[model samples]
Target chain A: MQLLIGTQAVELDKEGFLKQLTDWNEEVAIKIAQQEHIQLTAAHWEIIELLRKFYQLYELSPSMRALVKHTEQTLGAEKGRSVYLLQLFPPSPAKLACKIAGLPKPLNCI
Target chain B: MTTNNKSITCKKLLFISRHAPYGTSLAKEALDAILAASAYDQNLSLLFMDDGVFQLLSAQDPSDLEQKNFAAMLPVLALYEIENIYVHFESLQARQITINELILDGVQVIDSKTICSLLTQQDQLLSF
Candidate 1:
């Protein structure tokens, strides 16, 4: 069965997910993999999880401001600080994480 | 291999932006947010990007000028466990900043690619 979490429904099968990700017909999947260092396999599920949690709490998708503040508070100081969180997810960690997690992308994400 | 199923949480938020933390009241506001969030056991992290990194520069004499330098509040990070600090490597390089120039506490430097990867790993992300 295909799982529809946030951005869109993605199949659990590797090839199905790969095909769906490349449906953009652009190099986005490849670029994300190469530039963002996404593992492709693991990244999707992670994003879905993040997005679901964000929505559950806020009762809305995270806007940029919400995403940043939440990420900083949860991941930053809890560990070493924002640096590690940035290293794990930079610029828009919440967005990327949500994407990889398989959740719907935020409406106002940059 | 096991598939992972972790999600980002939505809790009280505190964002520490040292870079002029606010265009007008960025620093002051950021500190307020941090202090307020900390009260709720909320999540909080600080960023030292671009010119903001200077917020934690080692030595300071804000008192001599009568401008109560607030950087002192940074140390409270340890007590509150709000030590998530991030610095863009490119920004630092462009500014000709050396890691040694700042208060070397919980700061971390990240590259563009890694930053993108990190983004994909969060439930939320913000900038100052």
Candidate 2:
């Protein structure tokens, strides 16, 4: 599948994750969030940026537990709880947040 | 009257890695399995021997190969609480790798005799 950002086609996998990491930009993130029915807020942007940084360091998207732990370490406890993450990205926080972040679906999420 | 006991027991599982990190998928596969097992709250230990010791060497950059740097994943082991990591002392010696060269901290270096005892203590052994 592909996402059209003003006539530029960005390739995506079956699950709507970016096939090319470089394809991701703020505009692309907004488009994907629209598809997932999420409005890109400052709160959401904070986690998206964090996930990108995490992938840069670990080279893999984190499971929910790892995400919470890493967030606690970086952002402190108030924003790191699963409840806060769930409020930003619902249903399945790790999977949904990662999809919008243009990262591969988190391994071990199921 | 008979009573039913419903307590679940966590099994002791040991993963023995014996291959180099990049040449094949064995090393990555072992790491994936270790992370998966951590969610089950099992008693997990990882032992690196032979070429597997290479997985822990610092300053690994796989960008030229277009592969994820395997050493980068080692720190996640601690995050998952899979803390019983071990390295074969003789294997490191044979490869001429020093303990300081490894990236992950708090790994125990054990000789063959200790490895034997560790193996015997495991409820299951997973080899890669």
Q: Give lDDT tens digits, candidate 2, residues A1-110.
A: 99999989999998899999888999999999999999999999999999999998888888888899899999999998999999999988999999999899888877
Taking all chains together, each candidate's TM-score versus the true structure is 0.43, 0.92
Residue-wise C-alpha lDDT for candidate 1, range A1-110, written one tens digit per residue: 34443466534343223334333322334334344575544434333454456554433345444554565555463533434434556656555654444334544454
TM-score of 2: 0.92
Which structure among the candidates has the greatest TM-score?
Answer: 2
lDDT of 1 by residue, B1-128 (tens): 22343223334242526464223566655654564455444455555666776666667446555443545555544544566666677778878878887665678887667656655544444544
DockQ of 1: 0.01
Model 2 stretches with alpha carbons more than 4 Å out: B1-9
What is model 1's native contact fraction?
Answer: 0.00
Docking class of predicted structure 2: medium
